[model samples]
Target: MLKSTFLSVACCLFIGHHAFTQCIAGGSNAVAPYASNSSNKGVMFDITATNTVTISCFDANLPALSVGGYEVYFKTGTYVGFETNAASWTLLGSEGSLLSIGLNLATPISVPVNKTILAGQTYAFYITASNPILSTGVLTTTNSGYSAITSNSDLTVYGGAGITYPFGTVTANRAFNGTVHYILGDPLPVEFLDFTAVKVDQSVLLEWETESEHHSDYFEVERSLNGIDWNRLLTVKGAGESSVKEIYQKMDDNPLDGISYYRLNQYDFDGTKTSLKTISFNNKVEIGENDIRIFPNPIIDRFRVFGNQSELETLKVFNSVGEDISGSLTMTCHEGFTDVVFKDQVEGVFILKSKTNSQILIKK
Candidate 1:
């Protein structure tokens, strides 16, 4: 047995035969009585079915004046005819011919079909009343199941062309360091969001949380040395819904000597893609003349400095804005290496300047 469904007709009004509005279910519009010219009005029906169905239009006015002079078409194809039930379709209200009728009346009509439908098939019904002069009236119509054993199906109605239905899902899992680190889901369209990054020991960690998603397909993590030409580092999926959260993370083990920029490329399921806001990082780890080393370079918590010499003197750390963070000379440059530790400082870019009289170390 097929599923039960209902289709209700809504009335709409047009004035002066100039402007047009949508004709929804359970709506009505008032128009002034006309004498000669008949105006054109219509309602479109979108149906998704698996078997043939019947469409009927009815109003308060019947027999005296019937709905005959109108055009009907299917959005996906063409309408064959009104079928055998067309004549039996009922109408109510007093009516008369165009030459004799002076009072305003309502008319209704119906069209039935017996064609077979397939699963997931979509079809549309359009009814239009066209006349050269002024013909102002109301049209009411309904669609009902004619075949007894029709397949159980559903029909999604749309207002106009190019409208898309929201039918997607997304899921995320895995959390680390008090934050979610993994995500996967359907592709969504384009939108806006925020991303953040942090430096942990020798590895730079990236994390981004999403509040909502739409037609978003996936995201590509990109990295750049000079904030210019970027290369993709990783790809993350999107959640195609609202009121959901998605988290993504990636680690860049090898940071540049100066600064690095990162961005995300959000792609849609339809091949449409856009880039997110770019973030820059000023890495103070540099290779010097005596040895390649990194000091408390703006080291908020703790950091270690390394060099290729066995002798050392003083280690000075300054913030990226040239503010002195710490100055220390307690270093035993053994095997050309030493680690300086600074505790409880703000996280930001900094410069480490080290000197051994005969050898000087500078990192920005």
Candidate 2:
């Protein structure tokens, strides 16, 4: 959810002939107290084992910045260098609803790296935001790596911070702070897309589609009041081994009153499971449902919300399509009012908002 300081040394790995869990480097993983003053950042490393590595989860360290969120991307190979943006890179999903700086290495950020790196291949990754995060208009991966530092026999971490997708010019080898958590196995056989949860009347409807799958057994639908604790609601049969798109759905007939978090996990025939992605849905508005509203019903650029300081702080907005687009919107707060703006502007779209105490606002 946040971050920590990291120690720069060599790559260390824990291995098993079949499957074992290990991290990217050997040193203690955390954030650096200072910034390298670089552009976008990521990690570059090489795995030597014949067995592939599955990137489970990873965390980043921003020495002195609190960000709205981070848009993360990953690519295979040992990082070619100098990137402008993530136009060409593959998406590993996003991390941190609001990635802030702190000291928490025990928890891996939720930028689900459900990707598998081929045997004896290299890999690269980076995290970025719409705006600079460091105090000096920079975002850091922290300083916790070195050039050709072999942490063990199975893996070799190359160089310090690997600069990625620079907005301005370029800066390389700034030491990638934080560590990448990997599993000693191949990627999941099945691939999925568009996992969504929507409030359908009094219950919640969960739906997801798969592009391809092989040796897959079934999918587990789990729900949580908070994102931490999860309970398995039901299991749906998988496509087994299909090449076309497969659709699946589940119903949470007893969802929480306000916000409910839903997570999707797929299990293989051999019982190997991979956690896909987590999304949230607002069941209903409990209070202030009629009084809550946004100005300029059909906003062109921006809108205003009149509320106290506390109400403004807890405000969250979703699109008509039901995605948690809160992090995509910007906020400017005054004493008794707050200005809201969506960066990716579009016309004729509606917005759904949820504020403190289940207050709801719907605007076209």
> Which structure among the candidates has the greatest lDDT?
2
**Global lDDT of each model?**
0.36, 0.51
Question: What digit string (tens of lDDT, one per residue) describes model 1 on residues 212-281?
Answer: 6777778888888766688888888777564554566677787665667777677877878655545666
Work out the TM-score per prediction.
0.27, 0.55
Q: lDDT score, residue 309, model 2?
A: 33
* TM-score top scorer: 2
> In model 2, which range of ten residues has the least summed lDDT?
11-20
lDDT of 1 at 224: 83
Off by over 4 Å in 1: 1-191, 285-364
Instruction: Candidate 2: count the clashes.
Output: 12
Per-residue error for 311 in candidate 1, Å, reads 31
For model 2 the local lDDT of residue 216 reads: 90
Per-residue error (Å), model 1, residue 93: 64
